[model samples]
Target: MRILYGVQATGNGHITRARVLLPALRAAGVEVDMLFSGRQPDRLFNMEPFGDYRTCRGFTFVTDAGRVRRLGTLKQSRPLQFFRDYRCLDLNGYDLVLSDFEPVTAWAARRQQVPSLGIAHQYAFYHRIPGTGSAPLLKWSLQLFAPVDEAVGVHWHHFNAPVLPPLVAPSPYPLTEEEGKILIYLPFESMDEIRYLLRAFPEYRFRIYCNIPAPETQGHLEFEPFSREGFQQDLCSCAGVIANAGFGLCSEAIQAGKKLLVKPLQSQIEQRSNAVVLEQMGLGRVMPSLETEAVEDWLALGSGTPSPWPDVATALATWISTGRQVPIQVLTRELWRAESGNMLSLC
Candidate 1:
């Protein structure tokens, strides 16, 4: 079957999830075309696998100083371009359309009368999951942002709903027992602020990854350019992670059984809700701001038991190959069993 896969490039989490899904689809003998939206063409990384994917300025939120700036995001959005992209996309040749909360492809599929499947963490909001800041506006945005025919939601836990576990990168690095250093990846925050926070903890080593070019080393603090291989290496060795409460990294940390200290992006309802659920599940600690007290408290708390990772990508590929007409509950149950080791007590 010929499939059109759309991925949101607003954050690394969506791209990370797509990275795993792409190979799974190909292995299943499905012909796939990729479309990426949200970020600028130049900012995308590790993108050679998509096979000449299309890009556009569909939609993305602007962030500053570790916060999602509401006003700035409104100012930066280009509605005309978004509409044009949506109207211009051609879905005639593909047998199926799939989206990871990407607006352009979803909208175009809707307009063209194509059956679209949405696989994303955002879809989990439709179920009764642990969430905070569930305002009317947030609910409306979630529904309208990426409308699709079938929705498959991914989460850290089942929450007694049709939710699957997180799709994590293959376990390439050996699990180590070192617990002195922490891996930090807060892309939205300014580098200066991160340095200031880590500088206070002179005893703990911090390996920070950012978009900046120049690398710096001072005392126990180290700044390095972003490299997927290098980041995964540090992640394997570190005892814990300090990052925004984005779904991707938090899921990866949980899979690795690393201690987590998450500071959700301010003014983002989804992130706030994710933080709440993380705390409720005993998976991690959340801070309202990037305060030193929170970080110190988290560092002292130490790591939690590792949650079983799911092979959702393979399951998804099977479902897609079979034409996505299966009962959503059955598919979710299969994935849940794989994720929770058939231990219904975890749910």
Candidate 2:
């Protein structure tokens, strides 16, 4: 089947999901044409996986110093262009549009009455999961951002819902505990603030990945430009992770058995909810801001236990390739059952 996959490129997490699933889809003999939005084409890197992909000026949230700037976000949105792009998009040949919280293709698929499937952590909010408070705007955005015929939510826990486990590819590197080393990825926050936060822990070494012109070192802190290979290597070898509560990075940290200290992006419901669930699951610790006291306490914690998530990309790829004949609940049950089995084996 020919599928037009739409990815939200505002953050690396959504793209990360596509990176995992696209390969599985190809292996399953499904043809995929990708469209990415919410970020400029020039900003994207390490995109060897999705060849000759398309980009659009889709919706995106603006942030300033780890807080969502509502006014800034509204000012940047081009509703006219958005409508034009979706209306102009030709979805005739594609059998399905798989959206990862990408609005352009989702709206196009809906307008054309084509089948669309939403697969992302945000879709997990459709169910009665944790950390969903009385936030009307959040609710509206979640529903209106990317509506689909079928929603497949992914999360760290199922929460007694039909949600699939996090869509993380297994790490290629062997897990190693390099003590006193922590990998920091807080793309939404300022580098100056992060530097200040790290100043207290003089003994510990920090490898921060961000949008820098080049690699630089200052005492125990090392700042490097975003590189997939370098980041993965550091992640696998590091003792822990200090990052914003982005689903993709946190899920990867959990899989790598790295202890997590997350600072949720202020005003973001999803990040706050993720932090709450992580605390509830005892998988990680949370700090509302970059506080040295919290970091000191978190640094004293022990190593994390990795979650036994199944190969969800392969499973979803197979399901899509075979025409999605199986019920979602059945797929959910099987994946969770497989996870349980893995947990038992580990025990």
Candidate 3:
């Protein structure tokens, strides 16, 4: 089947998930074309995985100092161009369209009267789950931005729902001895602030990854350019992770059994809700801001037991290739087993 896959480029998490799913789809003998939206065309990195994907001026949020800037986001959005691009897309030859919460391709598929499937964490909001930041505008944006026929949501826990486990990169690095170091990836925050926050913890070594450049070294802090290889290497050696309460990193950290300290982005409902759930599940600790006390407290705690990460990419690919006609409960069970790491009969 010929498929059109749309991925949101706002944050690296969406791209990271797509990286895992794309290869699985190809291995299943599906012809796929990709479209990427949100963020400028020039800002993209690690382009090797996504082969010649289309680009558009799709929706994205604006953030300042670790907070989602609502007014800034509105001022920056280009609605006219967004509409024009949506109306102009041609979905004539494709058998199916898949979206990772990308707006342009979803709207185009809707306009063309084509069946579309939404594969994203955002879709989980439709179900009964823990949530925060419940303004009418945010709700409207999520629903209208990426509408789809079938929604397949991913989460860290099942919550007695049909959500699947997070799609992590195939484990490239083996688990290593704890080196008393911490990996920090808070892309939404300013580098200066991050540096200041870590300076207080002189005993712990911090390897920070950021988009902006940094000086050679501070007393106990080392700044590095963002590279998948470098990040993974640092992560393997680190005892824990200090990052925003974003789903992708948190899920991966849990699978690795690393201790976690997350700071949910301000005014971001999804992130705030994720933090709440993470606390409830005993998966990690959440902080309202990048406070030193919280980081120190998290560092003092022991790591949780590793949760097994099943081959979710393979399972989902198999289901899609078979035409996705299975009952929701059956699919949910299969996915839950993969997430839960328990071998029990699905009655």
Candidate 4:
């Protein structure tokens, strides 16, 4: 069957999920085409996997310092262009459209009456997941942002919901802990602030991955431009991870068995909720903002046990390929059961 896959490029998490699933889907003998939106074409990198993917000017949030700037986000949105893209997106030969919180493909699927499925962490909030109530309008906008015929939410825990486990690939690098080494990936925060905060802990080495133009080291801290291969190598060896509470990175950290300290983007409900769930599961530590005290407290603690989640990408792809005749509850139960008693349910 032919499928059109839509990915939101505003954040790396959506793309990360797609990265894990695309291979699995192809292995399942499904033909697929990828479309990405919500960020400038020049900004995307390490994207050889998608293979000549199409792009559109999609909606995105604007952030300053560490918080979402509502006015700026509004100013950045191109509703007319979005509508045109939506109307212009041709879905003639696609049997199904799979969306990772991408509005254009979802809307096009809706307008053309093509079957659509949303598969992303954001869909988890559709259920009674944690960290969802802070911004009511933001919460309400989820459905309007990307509506689909069916949605499969992905998260660390099922929370007694139909959500599946995080779709992360096994570490390509052999997992090994390097003492006194930590990986930092807070892209939303100011680089200068990160340098200042991390400089206080000269005892530990920080490998920061950001939008830097070049690689440089400042005393104990090493700054590198974003590279998936380099980042994965660091992730495999680092004793711990310090990053924004984006679902993808945190999931990778948990899979790699690294201790996690996350600073959620202020007013972003998804990250806040993700932090809450991480705390609830005793999987990681959360800080409201960038602060020395929070980092100090986290560093003093021992590493949490890795969840070592099962290969969910393969499982989901198999299910989707065979036909989604099986109930979501059945799929959820089996995947969680495969976790070897790692599942933590709130319901």
Q: State TM-scores per candidate.
A: 0.95, 0.97, 0.94, 0.97
Please give the TM-score that candidate 3 achieves against the real structure. 0.94
Give the Cα-based TM-score of candidate 4 against the true structure: 0.97
Whose lDDT is greatest here?
A: 2
Instruction: Give a tens-digit lDDT track for model 2, residues 148-229.
Output: 9988999887877888998889987988989899999999998899998999998999999989879999999999998888
- What is each predicted model's overall lDDT from 0 to 1? 0.84, 0.91, 0.83, 0.90
lDDT for 33 in candidate 1 is 95
- Candidate 3: list runs displaced more than 4 Å: 133-140, 213-215, 340-347
Which residue runs does candidate 1 get wrong by more than 4 Å? Answer: 342-345
- On the 0 to 100 scale, the lDDT of residue 335 in model 1 is 73
Mind sharing the TM-score for model 1?
Answer: 0.95
lDDT of 4 at 193: 91
lDDT value, residue 25 of candidate 2: 99
In candidate 3, what are the lDDT values of residues 136-156, reduced to their tens digit?
465466778899988888887
lDDT score of model 4? Answer: 0.90
Clashes of each: 0, 0, 0, 1
Provide the clash count, candidate 1. Answer: 0
